[model samples]
Target: MRLNIKITFFFLFITKVCLAQDWMQTPIPGIGNIEFPSDPEIFDQNGVLIYKLENDDAFYLVSIAQTDPSYNAEIEANLEEYYEGQLEGVEEASGGTVTFKQDIGIDGVSAIDARISGVANPELPSLLFKRFVYVNSFNVSAEFRPKKTDELEFTALKDQFFNSLQLDVSALGSSIVVDEVNGEKDAFKKGYEIGYVIGRIAFWVFLVIIAILVFYFIIRLLRPKKKKEPKATASKPVTKQKIECTNCGKSNSTEAKYCSQCGYTLPRD
Candidate 1:
């Protein structure tokens, strides 16, 4: 009977895995959208919205909260401290201990990534991977809890679910807006305008400098090099001219008045 039960459970597990192959994108009201490997069971616990998906191997969950405006200032003041409190809350609720925690960010918003282990019950999932994102007055949390940490499918699903989240920035309103006016400006507004103009001027100046440098280098490289001229060689030393003697057809030096062999008269140069 035990062996038969094991076989049935194995088949059920495989069936669940196969069914989860088709993922779906789900949007939470007032928060953001994320992908789930299968249709999630959504619940509202108090003011928090929870989206949950479970299989025989693991449990996936995402929770979102639009926090009170009063707490926004405190959260903004010390985000790390707020996250530490959140980590402690998770540990207390799950009866687990955080094995590792890392500071992370999503879309310029501060966040925390953490792993929890040592749950109270061994039958329950003892390993958990979690991420908490704080944006404006919103808090988003995602978690993946699996029976075994080494499972490749669980790891892949965790990564996919975490990466698929996209926050709806439009839902979060801006705190400040400045408009153009011709009237007298307040000190803060005047300073802001001056700084803006200076920043633009600096940016254009930097670009112009870079362009000039590039142009200079291009001209220098393209210019032709001057060709070297060959040096003039020294002229050969002049040799004394020889005169032919008419008497005996003997050669005589230009300086000689007469030929030595025939005593013939020679013309002077």
Candidate 2:
């Protein structure tokens, strides 16, 4: 039952991806329109269409991926619809896999355009890659690189995709040096601009307040309570209290045994 539920969710996830996303032309008018190629699930492979827009020697390649909601479990039921009624290829049961088949499209005629494609070993939440291969417009021997990162590295996927890259092909075209690559994402800068700094400050202040409250509670819970000091009973001062008896006109000392002037017994304490 649990396995059925998991599969059901996966199908729902695929359905969502198929239903929500529609191919639309992006910018630059109708230089190109992408068609959803037959979504085929190859056995251990993912694919996507890459469209390159080149103007004045500046090229921007955008990869369009078509696949079931591998990331979502809601629309797994519609996975077949995304595949156009095709089943996914058999894969090792140890790890889950989703496949995508892609067609690269470059609009218009390029007198000279160099291109490359390749897969990459993933690091983390980064998109999985295959490799990168370079080819000249002339279809002649161009270049191929398997390395992920190096100075003057040709094909590498770092962070998000970047568009502003300078193509430094010498006049002779014997060597190629790609420089002036722009548009590397400023994740922190963007986050900070959107009040990340303020959020961090608020978080720290909240933590400090929590710490102080915790310490106060601990000390309060641990410290011994006083016995109220027993309220030091206020001592009454001894007041001189002399008395005279009317019967004998006798003057008596306060708390005296008898009056000295008369042989009369006085009230004594």
| Number of the top-ranking candidate, with lDDT as the measure | 1
Q: Ten residues in a row with the worst lDDT in model 2?
A: 176-185
RMSD of each: 19.8, 19.1
- Clash tally for model 2: 23
lDDT of 1 by residue, 1-269 (tens): 45445545665665565445456666654555688766677666776667889876578899877778788888978999999999999999889999999997776677888988877766678788899988888788999887555778778777888888877766665331111111212443466557657866766675566556555665666689889999999999998878988888888777789998978777664
Q: How many residue pairs clash in each candidate?
A: 0, 23
TM-score of 1: 0.54
Candidate 2: stretches off by over 4 Å: 1-80, 84-194, 235-250, 254-269
Candidate 1 lDDT (Cα, 0 to 1): 0.73
Best by TM-score: 1
Looking at candidate 1, what is the lDDT of residue 139? 82
